[model samples]
Target: MRTVVYLVIGVFFGIVLFKSEAASWFRIYEMFQFGSFHMYGIIGSAVGLGIVIVQFIKRYKVRSFFGDKIVILSKEKSFYRYMIGGIIFGLGWALAGACPGPMFVLLGAGYLPIVIVIIASILGTFLYGLFRDKLPH
Candidate 1:
């Protein structure tokens, strides 16, 4: 079933995150402190791969398995809005010691304390959805 496939893929991704120590709080701390380049290398590689994937998708007109076209939306450019959002996100990441993706991985890895971060993330997302229309474009 599709759900099973999705679960398998997610588990595989979590394993990769764990193996690469991308889900490690110490690695994230080191990144912020400039104490090590390990996490930076991983993040940089991911960004590079993402750029290539985006280009490939655009060039090849990639479609979903369900036959739907994959559309990437272009948003209005707003410097202040981006700066504010990035500041908030960075603060949350620093405080929680984990971003959303790695927070879930940490939870799966038996860090029960990550539930607080997960709940806060969900609440933050909900609040954003409620207020996004009222915010600047």
Candidate 2:
């Protein structure tokens, strides 16, 4: 029952991504190139909403849908580690023209070539997990 509900939610999110053109490579390219504001507007709105929700969660002691307490943890700040990670992520996004989330959506939308991107993402994640302890915190 829970699995079905989660699947439904995931499908709905994929549909929204498709409808919003958030999964479009062209939109991503435009965002990186500053060719248009459409994608940026979408990203900004999501960030604003996220900030509001996070604040509310912190202030109101929000619980999960399943009744567990929500916990937000603070991590130690590392400037150089974060900068390097961000640069690599940005370069991957520009080159692939899709982030991890939307890459799945693209695969579901029948863009078969995105399989390579998805596979590469999975391998990258696996490698990260294997080497995470060796990396800077």
Worst 10 residues of 1 by lDDT: 64-73
Clashing pairs in 1: none
Q: Looking at model 2, report the run of 10 residues with the lowest lDDT sum.
A: 1-10
Query: Residue 62: error of model 2 in Å?
Result: 1.3
Please provide, for model 1 over 20-63, each residue's C-alpha lDDT reduced to its tens digit, 9 standing for 90 to 100: 99999999999999999999999999999999999999999999
Models 1 onward score TM values of: 0.93, 0.94
Task: List runs of model 1 lying over 4 Å from the truth.
Answer: none
How do the residues 18-64 of candidate 2 rate in per-residue lDDT, one tens digit apiece? 89999999999999999999999989999999999999999999998
Candidate 1 C-alpha error for residue 14, in Å: 0.8
